[model samples]
Target: MKDWWIYKGDPAVPTDRRLARLAEHRPPWRVFEGKVDPDHKVPSLDDKQYAADRERGAGYLADDAEIDLVNTALLLRRPLLVTGVPGVGKSTLAYSIAEDLGLGPVLRWPITSRATLRDGLYRYDALRRLEDANLTRMQATSDEQLLDAPEAEEGDARPADAVTPPADGIGRYLRLGPLGTAFLPTDRPRVLLVDEIDKCDIDLPGDLLTVLDEGRFDIPELTRLADHRRTVTVGTEDPDVRARITAGRVQCRAFPVVVLTSNGEREFPPAFLRRCIRLTIERPGEDKLRRIIEQRIGAGAAAAAAAPDGLISRFLERRERGELGTDQLLNAVQLRLAGAWTAPDEIGQLAQATLQPLSGPDAT
Candidate 1:
């Protein structure tokens, strides 16, 4: 397992090499069998979505230490708890993994102050179901009344069950969130990105401990009717792809490669931390910043190379002062090269606008 881990700062490990290592040291299958969607097959990374992932990943520049942590998380099948400052590529890690391993679209669950564990798992539209049920009842009643009205028109006298909606159609109101959908059984595991988890309520992480540990969850609404109905088809995170829930339970055939990102805003419980494989991303140093800037702006003219190097020096100085973000540095560098600031003095003056240290209450 340790042999599979690489400490290279690059995310561009060859796919064949990765697969060979995986084949040699496969983990125990915790995968669940999910209802297959023949129509919505997982596409290759050649699409626009994967293209964006590739671009962002190349720009993010994960160090060898970060790469090793990623491999460890993949081999263990445990949720990775990534802590870093904003714009440090914590959420981006998920996309990098997806693009590198050809793991299909990453199911991203963005957290907020109001987010809850159930919000990430699945959502049941009780109000919508109630409305649907009422509509069905009215349709049934109207049909019955027409039947007893002594045949107003020949075609109007249709079967009572014709317009009556199926009671089992309640399944339409249930939709699985990214977290729940990740648990569906599949030959390959999905990448579940829990973005900005630090924004979640204190209890949210604690609430997830069980679901993460057990690799399954039950929908009580479906569970109640399990005895009456053999299988209920419910909507999944993927469009047009639905899964059947037997006994109202969703269990993963293969544990999802879950990546939960935090910005060091809050502390999680020790229990929650213990369940995860943790990694903290450090700020980009000079070499990494240079590579990142080069990736974003690209290599071309000697002027371009010099422009980024000069900006990198100033960016590092500002960073030491704890004011500007790495993204701001990229923006400054790009602006410096794009404009008609032929004079170095003019470029420096414009760069100050973006490179200036953040001030005021929001600085933190």
Candidate 2:
């Protein structure tokens, strides 16, 4: 993506050399103080804890090919662009990677129509500025009175102990947006989920090229003040600006795991595409579907026993006839189990009613 060697330098190196470089950046896997074995850096489903995470969320069947792609993205420190239909778990890759590396869950930025660069970096606060100005005025007023009244004795403490110059206004308070937070100086890399990028305007994706390539962004508003002043009034998560300045600009300590998802609705600019490794998610196979259903429904044996003879046959018949998808099959099975529908007639009726109409031409 964007010539990985451009900002970060040449990527032409042996596997071991690349891994060594990644280590120097303090990648997420290195910062984890958890049960993840360092010798086996890539945590797989074979690991119990990793399996638990999979169970908690829909797991990515990270086949060997997928692993290679993941490793390449990490080594290059470029964005991984996942494209697939809805419900195929493209966005979940970020979460899984974060969990595998013990970097915690991802910080998600759900793209929308109004999203902009500033929206993803920081938000200005007017209330804090007003309070700061008010405080400054009050202090100035008191100093004026003390100066006008009389002169103090020599060596006496100055009347105005130097007004601490009101705290920087809310405009200086910059809390990291999801993207900003992901770049924050962490002991380990953070995962950033740019979900449904297709929903955003065309220009938004292009705008991200700079920061993504540079591995940093300057919060001019915050940086300008932070560089020159010790304390500035900035917005806080608090309701009142007068309350406190709790947020500040944070710089990146390491590259982050950036995953951007798309629903294949719109194409991105060539420049944007050039900076990402694209992965297309395929629909789950029959066996995978069965496993998913068994995991979700708790009727594994029952569903399997009945599948070959009639249940699966009927399910496929409907699916072949464009009557249902995998989700509906699972839904019907769960309903059958919950209702104790053991007889073929009962099960068929329930499955047909639940799935058949939904896929029909007139359904929508």
Candidate 3:
């Protein structure tokens, strides 16, 4: 099934027409809004953003195994379950794929102890509904009085301005959660990041199996579309000047790129694992670490260049010695730069202070 949304340009076309074109051509499972960040040359990972992302970080070293896993997920149309130590860029893989594929903004669902199927699918905005209910009630009361009064004009029989009774706001207030947003109607492929999935309750992963297998969910609160229908509107935050509206269950015409991350804290049920393509993210090599630091800390032309060689060496040595991980390396670089540490002594002190001794299970 193809995505039906289309874009027609105004007489005066803008320079960012590429963004609109990308949106127009997106597959059913993809969501595309025109350039999210226009100032940044990358255009926020929409179809038009691919070229810029490639130019920016093309040389960064990534493991062939990890790259192959990504390729397999894309080909097989299954969720890629990435298990790894924290700070090893397991979460970053989703963004990297979004950037590489020009898939628009990554929809992230940060799993917590309380995360559930409902939380991943939709979040009810009760405050907005309450305000809307008050407005509708006042409007209805005013209209009743207007109807009771005599009509000012002859044959002006318009049923007291038939107030379109506010839609049943109960279920209408359900807005798409990160997972729901990924399934919403769109023009381009979307990347769904189910981050820290191990942190969620056990049942949550099993609950996702159905959606992962069938790519459709039923919201009984809203009207159902034809069975096996490929698209539905979940809901959207009001765009400027528009009132909040609920879109039905959006079906995907094309499978989405689903990247789920786990920190190896808990084991998923075998059934849950069966529905996904699992991959383990290994620690970064020295070369990859250097590139990561340079990308994040602004190398050469962007800032006063730091001793990238020395910093990376110390970071790797400490990591090998089990004192720090990749996350600390990036943190140390930022802290050192912020503190205006350009000398060897300052770098040593900064690394030691930032990377505390690992304890208990983490040390192993």
Best by TM-score: 1
Question: Which window of ten consecutive residues has the lowest lDDT sum in model 3?
Answer: 1-10
TM-score-superior candidate, 1 or 2? 1
Q: Taking the tens digit of each residue's C-alpha lDDT, what string does model 1 give over 1-364?
A: 2445632323466665665555455465533445544443544557774677666654556777888888777777679999987767788888877766767778889999999888888899999878867887888787778767874665775664554555657688899899998887665678899999988998999999888877889989889997888578888887677777778888876578899999887889999998899999988877777677766776652235345547677667666666466788777767756774546666566556676665432221
The clash number for model 3 is 9
Better structure of 2 and 3 per lDDT: 3
Q: Write the per-residue lDDT of candidate 3 for residues 303-359, one digit (tens) a residue.
A: 332345566766666676664567676677676566656576676676667665464
By TM-score: ranked, best first: 1, 3, 2
Is candidate 2 or 3 superior in TM-score? 3
Q: What CA root-mean-square deviation does each model show from the true structure? A: 3.8, 9.6, 9.4
- Number of the predicted model whose lDDT against the real structure is largest: 1
| Per-model CA lDDT versus the true structure | 0.74, 0.61, 0.62
**Per-prediction TM-score:** 0.85, 0.66, 0.68
List runs of model 2 lying over 4 Å from the truth: 1-58, 131-172, 230-250, 295-306, 309-333, 340-343, 346-364
